[model samples]
Target: MQRLLVALLAAFDAAIAAAVGLVVLLAPLTLLWTLAFGITADWGALWPLTGTLWEFGHGVPLAVTIPDELLVALAIPAQAASFAVSITPLAFLLFTLLFAARSGARAAAAGTWLLGVLSGTVVFTAISTAVALTARLDAAQTPLLLAIVLPAAVYFVGALCGAVRVAWEEGDGGILDRLHDRLDVHEDWAPVPAAVVRGAAFALVGVVGTAALALAVMTLFRGGEVVALFQASRVDALGATVMTLAQLVYLPTLIVWAASWLAGPGFAVGVGTAVSPAGTQLGVVPGVPVFGLLPENSSMWMLIVVLVPIAAGAFAGWAVRSRLVWEGTPLGTAQRAVIAVGIAVVTAGVGGIAAVLANGSMGPGRLSEVGPAALPFMLALGLEVLVGAAILLLSPRHRDELAEERTDRWIAEMSELEPSQAPVVPVPGIPLPRAHDQAFDDTAPLDDVRGFRPPTGNRD
Candidate 1:
């Protein structure tokens, strides 16, 4: 009964997530459609447009084709008339992942994480299937199979991660518990997996934070350039609003590019352009307002930005080490080494995935290659992080750290003892009271000191 309830609730959560994403797309689109073409406009195209965009936002690439009449009227080059828009907005996908994660956490709390994740994924996939089947656009077409699978995959992965994270800390009384027990048998390696995961999470957070800070600094310094581009576009209020919203949605994509820059590989704005801290090499580039953030020139000294990821890795290692000490589960040098490597590997994997999502065609011609190359970014970040983590994790244990661990262990042991079972400590020339002696009640009134007498007991 409990499992069934959890599954049902999870399915409900999945439906809400999908519905909310659709509504978000539909609402603004509805207003825009009405304002642009009035009630006489083809309302049938709205749902298809919304659905196609939703699919695109989930990382599905669209094969965009300009209508023959529009192309001829606009005098667009034949080569530029059709192109693939693979760079996803990522906002919708992010929303779904976060909602699914929340639902999975709830399910883990309910003690049915696996069932909840499976049920939620099944429902999400069904919704995706319906959307794929119904949403057909003559201008923008997405792969049917990809449209059905990608969103569901995103939800599934997010839910599994969230559920496992919670269950790992608070036993799920099933598979996780058994796995934990098995890991426990090997004391040295017991904390390795959890520590690695924790450290990797910390590293990713640090990288993202640094990337965001860099983006903010760029915005502050380059605000005028962005504004200039926006003004040069000469867009009306609605177009401007739409442009702003689009930029906002692509913020995460920009952050990923910034991270790649910090990692030293940088990213490409077009086929032959390179925007890196080391140097900025380019020819003609798109005039998107966000592109204004790109540095026109770079100095060799700017390569020092690569240190950012290293610092993040070092911070992760310190955090993991502190946690291990706090928990009285100090690992051996080999175990720490494995943890450091694991942190690097995990960080690299995440970086690679982000690069894959962020690096895709933005338009026809030179715009075909945009964002960072996944392999370079991953290898660079992994190596840099490994160096930093190794510096912390592979180093000899400090005396202070060992002393703190011992102190914590002692305190925990003492805390577990009953009052009567607590051992007494004696000071030189000061006898300790015996445990069997009558205990004084703090609530009772104190008697006069003049009439007070010592109990008859050992004085030594």
Candidate 2:
């Protein structure tokens, strides 16, 4: 049963991945074709062509629109040609092979999924763009063209890339070794189960957090009491101080929590659970008593109040533990804190300034009319600067836990150490480059490096 389930899941994943790869390759072709040929194509003619193309090429009769036909025509042919040349079975195969070579089974699975998603997005965009662009084109030609061209193009490109990737990896010893080295460390951890659980849990938390935040913010805005308070403020130094303090406290709290939510379960889950609204009746969390103190109309206020503490708690927890609940690798305390605070402050300041400028009255309708939109832009820039400054001042340390894993694998491979033993000394023949040398060099051609052979002499 377990084997069957795993096989089914793998098949599903592969299908999705292939679909995505086809789309990615197709989008650019569609875009280029639309630009070159113009949007005024005959849809009636295009539809039949598209249907024929899918039937003959991909062996699937997918329904597509006229504008989509135009795009498909452009993308499909090139993809088909490449696939023919390479003789690869599926588009996602390249990504899978690359991952397998570089980081073993786990990495291969992740890379395959990532590539598949990217491909799918590309295809969706291509079809959508084509439809929008050629809306006014001749209806008959549009459909015929799409039906004939799109599927063939996408499939061919996918196959071509997959074949090329596999061939390249198989031929290159250094590249293959590097991939194996990268994947070696996490052999003990079962990736599929962990990934499935984490993905589902985080998704659930995200939906709940988003709904809660939206409800709270909408409620606060409708109440109108806060607006009145802002309007009634006196123009004295004391008033300014009080106003600033209120803004500082309230805005930061709201912003931080909002940021946490954006960061998802990794950062927000702990915070969300920790925060309690004052009093009874409407707690942020079930069975908690924090919602009672909020004014009847102050939903926004309640949300902010609840989120601020949650953000703070989550940040503190993450800082100390070095790992977010869902993450495999650990981060330093300082890094966690900086990320939390930076995101929160920047979001709140920009959002607040934009709101004020948009709604605030400023003398005779002249500056008020044109200046409101500009305020948000200016605020966004200012917030960016503030966040950058905070990052500089805090000096957060990024712990390269993933890199360490890779290094350990490299060391183990070199030393011929057993999986259970501590990593032995570096092997003699492997040439380990210095950190600076390993940094990416854009000017260097990867193809040339592939043909070069390293010395076989043992350094030790």
Candidate 3:
């Protein structure tokens, strides 16, 4: 009965998560549409449009076709009237992913993680499919496969992450615990792998932190331009507010692009454009406020920005070195090098993925291709980081460090030894002379060598 109750609760929580994301994105738009168009607004079409926007948020590519008559009447070029809308602001998807993760975690904590994750995922999937089937816009039709697959994929990943977290924190006689125990059993092989992960994490954080700082500084100098573009858009307060919110969600994405720029591959505003510290080769760009931060053909000295990734890598390597000092493991220099290199390689892979996601079309023509080239970005970042890691990893250790490690190992071994192995103290053997017997003799008999003796004040 309790298990059944948990399953039902998981499903209910999953449904609530989907509803929350939908309602949050939908409700405001619905209210704004009513205010803007009043009773004359096609309420039916509005709901469907809201649904379409919701679908787009989950990464479903959208094709928008403007009517031929409307394009011709507006005197717009035929080519500009219809364009693919594949780029998405990921805030809603992030919300849904986090919410689903929470639901999965709650379910896991309740007793059965497997049932919780599976049930929640299934419920979310069904709701997503229903939403997909019901919400179709006349102007925009999403790919049917994307409509079902994308949401399901997000929910499943969230649930898996949640389940893993739960299993790690509180085992359920599960596979995670088993794996953990196995790893623990092989203690000799664990430290380097663990250190590698920690170092990679530190490196990634450094890159992001540096990018954020750069963004803040760039914003300060370019605030006026951003404001000018925002004003030029002429969007109303509500519309502007929505746009601002969407941009905030993509802030992380931009940070990655900035990191790429610092790494030297730079990012694109359109085809044949490159905005790197090395040079600015942009032809045309959209009037989005964020694009205002792009550098205008600056100086050759800016190419020095490529040093940031190398610095980040160095910091990561230094961090690993510090950790290893206390780790007291007998890891070889070669092993350290391998681990550091692996961390850099993984960090590079992350850079590649970020470049791909952060670089995509915001509009047609020159605007279609944006962000950094993944391959170049990844290679440059990885190589730069490896240089830093190698500096620390391949360096010779000081003799003091080796001596300290030896001392620590000795202490550890001492703690493990049995008390029976310790040396014993012998009892005194001489039942020697009484005071009277000693007084009778001019010289006292010599005490046995093994016996305790009193100190004499005289010296020869």
Candidate 4:
């Protein structure tokens, strides 16, 4: 496990990842386009498309400029049409994440995770630089710095996560593990970690569940429209398959949009569109099948759906409260409140990040602006969960209730362990006696210690 060898393997892993992702994107596309459109352009021309998609998947924006000649054919008087396309499918990112994680975990086990992550990032940055420099397609432009930095960022995050995960579990004695040990010493900070972690999980589940339910309802109500749009595409099974697969890749992004919707901010498919319960106001949307799920015109009653995020927050708060109640000792009410808010803050930060990733341009013009506002979504979501959690955590726990819980827990533990005493005896006429009770005589004659004579033998 030499540092140099670890670095090399990490780079090799990244290279293989990129190669496989490109192949997956290009192979099916090549076959489908050739069959469907007779490959009007040379096979080499498709490389730029693949390259552009690669950059897109890394969350890089593409500047598209239309040629002047097309304007005349389309009877348009616009001088020069230029717009940015920023819709990232996330499939490439997901693939790289998994690959880099594997590489980093292996490197961490070898005690060279730093070198491994650095090497992979360096290679990825270099590859991205080359692609940005040479992969322009038909007047399309890639941001030079973003192209170099974005993919490397993704790789760095993935590698760091993987390395830390393994390092944490295996006790690699690395700086990360050392810092973790140091942090674990702070009693004041102990409850924060559990509350934050559990709260985040709870919020994630709640928000995602809300989205799923909404999506299901949409599918049921607007099933015909979705089907009609699919039929209108007039594509053969192969084309439909490709389209379906592409949509599947953006599923997580859609879920994020749904979360935004549930949070009351809603999301836009295009610039002027706002699909919220406040009432849907939309223009002509693109022919994406998922767009068919939009309600024609939402009623004012629909605005009540904002409760979804509030409910999600409450769920998260409840989770944090439960964890603190079970695992925590007596703390000041202020401290408990602080712990609950801390969890909300962490979850809000995560939500904001998701909003940022989910919100981006789909294509030129109106389609460019889409998805939720990050700051607003975070604040709204955080406040909701925080309110519910604070109410529960800061409330006084009755001593009786606490005692009952402890007693129940103790009984459960006792039931689980092997008993040290003999087995209980079962009597036909009476209830089975416990081993402890069997050792004592309940009906024995007692001697008086107050000088009064007690019968040595039973009167019976």
Candidate 5:
């Protein structure tokens, strides 16, 4: 009965999540439509546009074809009439991922994570299928299969990841428990998986934090340039508002680009453009206000920014090592090395995924090849992180660390000892002469006490 309840709740949660995403899109687009078209608006197109965009936001690529009339009116080139837009605005995707994770965590807490996750995924899949079937945009079309699968896959993956994390930590009394028992047999190796994941999480947070900081600094210094671009665009208040909102949605994507730049691979604005700390090369780039944040030039010395990611990795290693010491599970050198490698791999994998979602076409022609190349960015970041993690993880233990370990061991030993088994200090034996065994009467004590030495020395 409880399991069934959990599944029902999970399905409800999934439905709410899907509705919320659609509403967010629908709200803004509705206002724009009403303002532009007034009473004569083609209200039928609203749902389709919102659904298609929601799908696209979840990483489904859209084939955008300009209408013949609009193309002719705008004098657009025939070659640029249609193009694919695959670079996703990560904000919506992140929202869904986080929400699903929360739901999965709740399910795990309810003691039936598998059922909950499956229920949530099934509901989400149904919604995606309905959207694909009903939301048909003649101008911007998505693959029917991809439209159905991508969003569902995103939710499933997120839910699975969240459930597994909770189950592993809290013991699900099932598969995770069995796996944990197996690991317990090899005490030295048991912590490797958790430590690696922890370290990787730390490293990713550090890298993202640094990227955000860098972006902030750029915005501060280049605020005027961004404003100038906004002015040059000559957009009215509503258009500017929409543009600003669009850019905000892409902030995470921009942060990924910044991280890639810090990693040394940089990214591209066009076919032959490069935006890296090492240098900058460009020709006829788009005049988007966000693009104004790009550096017009860079010195070779700027390449030192690569150290930021390495430092992040080193911090991760330190964190994991500290945890090991605290838990009294000091691993061997080989195990630690594996941990370092694992941290790097995880960080690289995450970075690569971000790169994939952040890179692709924004428009036609030269704009198609935008953002970082995933392979180069991943390899560079992984190698750099590996170097940093190895420095901390594989290094010899310090004197302080050894002392801490000894202290922990002592505490453990003391805690394990029973009261009866506790050691007692022995007192040394001292010999004493037996007292006189006589019972002299109190009445005759003054004259004949045992061995009486009466007033001999001090009497005079």
Candidate 6:
């Protein structure tokens, strides 16, 4: 088991290394495109620096370069610090996934893998989006960045997830056993409702925390002075910052939500809905007519739609609590899938409508045209919600299986005990007689045995 775990971990590490390598290799191509296109006519010299940083950081750098004009530098150290902080969640996720998988947590393993992939995609999109937004950055650079970053991120994330999974499954005391103890209500009772509630709460907290963190980061880093500096220098610092910050915030939320889902269904939905409000808003596109009369803000409509699904999922979970007998058996696959899709649709519609409304309200053409990068992020979020919900709902069955296994183990251990194996009482300086030998010596007479023999042959 230890060997298997080591092998799995090694594999995961290799995959992550390959991903990093791939991203590094693709940096030069993007640099070439930037040089050719004259995107930032004045900031061309900075591309080399940006490329160097990108290569060094595994495509996780914080520098903005215009097409061919000028460059404005931000606190690179600060950005890098934040980036490192943000990546910690990804590392945690990778570790958790490999552990869960190796420990035989099928549902959790699946959920983690999905989340890791989604995170990678989000990161890749953020990088590409940053490049695309840079007016001075070559258009060709966008594709090149995507080509390199996406695969690298995915491979690394996948490898980490796979390794953790192997370790978890093969390691002593599986996660399932631990989860069973945590969720166990009684010998015969299943703690489905409790698990769901806990899971949902964790997810919600994680999502809200992530969003707040993103906002805080943006507020701290996206100052008017910084924006102006980049703008004056004809560098796309603000846009790059926005993209990077979004990725940083979103990645952690994915891991948190995934972990929570494994712990409970309600939590997964709550987190999924909370973290994915932006996507939900987008899904409510056009807008939902409130009261069939007044047209509400798309954001408002999106909120309503997203809330409805969450509420429905919660209610469903509650209803089936008593019926669920095992961990991972509370909600069926179809039901979970429905809820996930519903949540995604609601989130996307609302987010889209809200974005459109906000843009329209701000004035026409206020927000510049950007690629559909946010769309994939939203879609990934929605999918996460669904997957998480399913995992939570199904957890009861897994829990029950673990409980039974534990019980069986306990019984097996007890069965090994024998009365004959009881500790013997030693008589000092005297040899113990065998029970059979004593029985055969009955010829000494039962009456004579009425008087007890003193150990020292002294009458007392």
lDDT against the true structure, each candidate: 0.92, 0.35, 0.79, 0.76, 0.92, 0.38
Model 6 per-residue lDDT tens digits across residues 25-45 = 356445554665557554554
Consecutive 10-residue window with the lowest summed lDDT within model 1: 438-447
Q: Model 2 over residues 1-460: C-alpha lDDT tens digits? A: 6434433444444345444544543454354445545687533444333323222223222232334565477664432221111111121333433322332232123334224333433443354334434332232222345433444344334433443344334432445446555645645322322222222233223323553574477446544554444445534544454454434323323332333322221111111122222212222321111212133322223434434323433433333233332244333444444444444344444334423322221112121121112343334323432333334324444456456656766865857853334333443443444445443421344345545675688888
Which ten contiguous residues of candidate 5 have the minimum total lDDT? 433-442
TM-score of each: 0.91, 0.25, 0.82, 0.78, 0.91, 0.29
* Order of the predicted models by TM-score, top scorer first: 5, 1, 3, 4, 6, 2
Error of 1 at 238 (Å): 1.5
Which candidate, 5 or 6, would have the higher lDDT against the true structure? Answer: 5
Cα lDDT tens digits, model 4, 1-460, are 4888889999998788777877887887788778777847477767878787788887887887778888778765473377777767666777888888988899899987888888987887787777777777876778888877888788888888788778766767678777767767976665565566677678778888889787888789998998888898898898788778888877777777788878777878787788887878999888878788887787888778777766776777766666555663445676677777886787788888778877887766688888887888888778876776676667778786488678867777768765544345543334444556655633322342234464588676
As a whole number from 0 to 100, the lDDT of residue 251 in candidate 5 is 95
Residue 422 lDDT, candidate 3, scale 0-100 = 34
lDDT tens digits by residue: candidate 5, 184-235: 9998888999999999999999999999999999999999999999999999
Off by over 4 Å in 6: 1-5, 8-12, 15-21, 24-171, 174-303, 308-312, 315-460
- List candidate 4 stretches off by more than 4 Å: 2-9, 37-41, 72-80, 102-112, 165-170, 231-245, 320-335, 398-401, 404-460
Q: Report lDDT (Cα) of residue 199, candidate 6.
A: 40
Index of the highest-lDDT prediction: 5
Candidates sorted by lDDT, best first = 5, 1, 3, 4, 6, 2
Q: Write the per-residue lDDT of candidate 1 for residues 1-460, one digit (tens) a residue.
A: 9999999999999999999999999999999999889999999999999999999989899999999899999999988988999998878888988999999999999999999999999999999999999999999999999999999999998899999999999999999999999999988888899999999999999999999999999999999999999999899998888899889989998999999999999999999899998899988877888889999999999999999999999999999998888788888889999999999999999999999999999999999999999999999999999988899898889999989878988998989987667665543443455545613321222353345565888778
